[model samples]
Target: MTALGFLYPGHSAEDDYPRIEQLLGSDIRLPLVHTDIGEDAHRVDALLEMGSAARLAAGVEELRLSGAEAVVWACTSGSFVYGWQGAHDQVRSLARTAGLPASSTSFAFAHAARELGVRRVAIGATYPDDVAALFAAFLKDAGVEVVAVRGSGIITAAEVATWDEEQVLALARAADHPEAEAVLLPDTALHTASHIQALEAALGKPVLTANQVTVWEALRLADRRVNAPRLGTLFTKEPLVQVH
Candidate 1:
């Protein structure tokens, strides 16, 4: 079994990993390290905007201490709010901190989209329009076009976590455009892995959610190839290329 580590901001392990485990079947082991970055709303935006290298480094080190082969910074806004260059630097800093392969949820989205050969994407976010704009720009820099975007104007991470699957699917279906080849729902706090298959069935296209891409990217880094159809089309479909 391949072991992968997830660094979450402020969510419980019980709520996060079950879907991933279900998607990967009963074979893979995912150990998560939860950091309480979301408790203080005042510092949340600052931490995300200015780049919390020290805190992020601490989180990565904790995951490494827990025997993680590879670590992923699981917060989307925490990484992408820094813009393209800042995001790249954050990943490099994480790699240095953990002394292992490191990636962020934002980076995973880009890599997943690129690997799947998806050119145009519709984005659904639970953030303000400005924050969503930053995410869209980051994807554009990665060669994916943002055909459409919708934001839920949600502020708190806890509120986002409380969002049910029906709400998320409704938002995704409403946000999707006919021209878009894929729909990206990028917020790690939201429970997206559980809703991916349903969203794909509704949209009739691939749906890349935050946790899905994060897990997939971590597995890719660890040299684990999973073909769990219940997860969604991405995993069931052949990888666009072999990383090795």
Candidate 2:
């Protein structure tokens, strides 16, 4: 079994990992270690602390013992709030500490978009407008265009985790732009594993959600892929080769 370790920040949607594990297959395992969420607010200062090296480092031992081959910082806001370079440094530190490949949800979204050859995407965010803008900036640095960004103004991961199927679909529909090749929901705290296919069917385009990309990112770190059509378009197709 290929084990992917996830250093999730707090308790919002950590459950998404297990659901994705079941969807991926019996041969794949997702072991999640919840890092300390100093403050669950989606604010900048709080997120920086939430994704700090110290908090992330605390989980490495647990994941190492879980037989994880690669580790991911599974919180989107926590990582993106650090910007592109900062997030990279965060992952690098985590990898060095864990002695495994490391990545974060922010990069996962960027890589997922690149893998799908999607240059333009619309964001359906659960964060405030300012926080969502930071995510847009991070994506822009990664060479992805944010056609539009719609924020829910939700302040905390706890609030985002309470979102249901209807809320998820509504956010996707509201955030989608005719010019966008894909729609992205950039919040790992939101429960979306069960609604990926439904969101795609509603938008008639590829829908990339946080938890979905987080799992895909983990598999990529392990140089592995699995057939999981139910996980949405990201899983149904082969990764596109991007020529830099």
The most accurate candidate by TM-score is 2
Error of 2 at 123 (Å): 0.4
User: Which pairs of residues collide in candidate 2?
Assistant: none
Instruction: Give a tens-digit lDDT track for model 1, residues 172-227.
Output: 99889999999999888788777777889999999998888888899888988898
Q: How does residue 96 of candidate 2 score in lDDT?
A: 98
List the candidates' TM-scores in order.
0.93, 0.98
lDDT of 1 at 216: 88
| Deviation from native of the Cα of residue 74 in model 2, angstroms | 0.2
Worst 10 residues of 2 by lDDT: 235-244
Q: How much is 208 displaced in model 1, in angstroms? A: 0.6
User: In candidate 2, which residue ranges exceed 4 Å CA deviation?
Assistant: 242-244
Off by over 4 Å in 1: 12-14, 38-44, 47-51, 242-244
Once model 1 is optimally superposed onto the true structure by TM-score, how far is the C-alpha of residue 120 displaced, in angstroms? 0.2
